[model samples]
Target: MAAPPCDSSAHRAFDFWLGEWNVHTPDGKLAGTNRIVSEYNGCVLHERYDTGRGYSGESLNTYDAGRKVWHQTWVDTTGTLLLLEGGLRNGSMVLEGQTTGADAKLTRHRITWTPNSDGSVRQLWESSEGNGPWSVAFDGRYSRK
Candidate 1:
């Protein structure tokens, strides 16, 4: 059977991130590489991340029709799993969630993806504990491969 059409704007919100990319840190150091592919008639985005140091992970991203939001589940070889949920806002995809840190404190995590005019993408990850200010956890730029 043919797959259902995913032509809605919501489903295509993340299309700008679809491609093979080399990720770099803010200092210009190589961070990793990623390959993002659209699957299931564009209903799903599959991501493969390799840190080039034997560390790798995969994430499945999708738009939940019922919830009207985008969701992502990432699992890595290091046994780290992260689940984020959100949708596009002001041309950027912002996903927010809560996770427990090593100190057993709950941290609010927010990740934002912005597409640049040059076709590169910027990803910023921040975390905050309680009512504390958010601190940058990761900031990376993705250039097309």
Candidate 2:
């Protein structure tokens, strides 16, 4: 027997980001590099990130059919872990999650990935605390490598 294809439209929502990329800050400063690959017959997106500063992380992203949402689990060398869940909205992949920081304070984290016309992707990560205004933690652009 052979495996069936994972060709659902929902599964391809994040396909635009599947590639090797050079991630940079909005002002064009090189921040890091990332490689996103489709695995398990497109059911999962695996990301490898390297910051060149002895830091690295990996994330596994997938779409949950029953929940109709995309989910991601990220773990970094610094022992930080984040789990985010959301769906594609307004042409961008947006995910939000809440976690308790090392200080034992609750925080909300949101990330959005937008595809640009020039074949690049923009990733914006923001955080908020206790209904406070969201602040950008990471704003980077991913250009094809």
Candidate 3:
């Protein structure tokens, strides 16, 4: 029998991030906890993150066969919605998008998730304003819980 549609290696590119994790800042402060699970016959990855201080977010990630890219839709408690798309690059998943702030300023958001040799994952979020220099918004490391 043939393998399932979602069993392709492309669909499994994000498998390294599948698991419960303890997220910490570079300084070793506990930033939050996250849980990522594969679902929909491995066609989708669902992630839930909580800061344990009333801040939480969830995202659904999938690989678009037609677009040949990975997509992510994230929604947070603050009513922020982010739609990002990209694919594997340089051994990491890099996704980027643009959003307009309440002040009507255009902001570019880019996030990269890289798996480390120590079995940990590093996530870095950067933002730039209207072609300005990129600034780090968040940098966290994920270790299996």
Candidate 4:
């Protein structure tokens, strides 16, 4: 079968975010660096995150033809994996997914991608412990360098 078309701009919406960037927590604490490289083949985005705690993770994002949305799968060195699914909105790509299994906790996460007029992009990751409150966890700023 032929590959379906990815009509959603999400395939290119985050194009401005394809670069290296510094990350910070909501409290203004330095996190580390986040690097995103385009696969250049499909609507796929590769991600690498280095945290101040000496931890690192890699993620893969792609456009879902059936769902007509963008989704991301994250896996860290610690063997933790999360599948986040959502779509773009208001120029921001938002994704949210939860965990449930033998080694899973009910955690919800949302990622927002914002591109600025000055050629800078702000990507934010927020999580909620439950249905309680949403707290910003990761903030990544990328500038064309």
lDDT of 3: 0.96
- The top-ranked prediction according to lDDT is 3
For model 2, the run of ten residues with the poorest summed lDDT: 1-10
Candidate 4 lDDT over residue span 60-123, tens digit each:
9987767677788999877778899887788778888876546555778888888889877777
RMSD of candidates 1 onward, in order: 2.0, 1.6, 0.8, 3.4
Report the error of model 2 at residue 101, Å: 1.6
* Top candidate by TM-score: 3
TM-score against native, each model: 0.92, 0.95, 0.98, 0.78
- For all candidates in order, the CA lDDT equals 0.92, 0.94, 0.96, 0.76
Local error of candidate 3 at residue 12 (angstroms): 0.5
Candidate 4, pairs of clashing residues: none
The Cα RMSD in angstroms, rounded to one decimal, for candidate 2 relative to the true structure is 1.6
Residues 60-121 of candidate 3: C-alpha lDDT, one tens digit per residue: 99999887899999999999999999989999999999999899999999999999999999
Error of 2 at 112 (Å): 0.3
- The better candidate by TM-score, 2 or 4, is 2
- Give candidate 1's whole-model lDDT: 0.92
Give the per-residue lDDT of model 2 (tens digit) for 1-145: 6545567899899999999999999788999999999999889999999999999999999999888999999999989889999989999999999888888999999999999999999999999996899999999999999
Tens-digit lDDT track of model 1 for 1-145: 7546677888899999999999999999999999999998789999999999999999999999788999999889988778999999899999988877678888888999999999999999999997699999989999998
Candidate 2: which pairs clash?
none
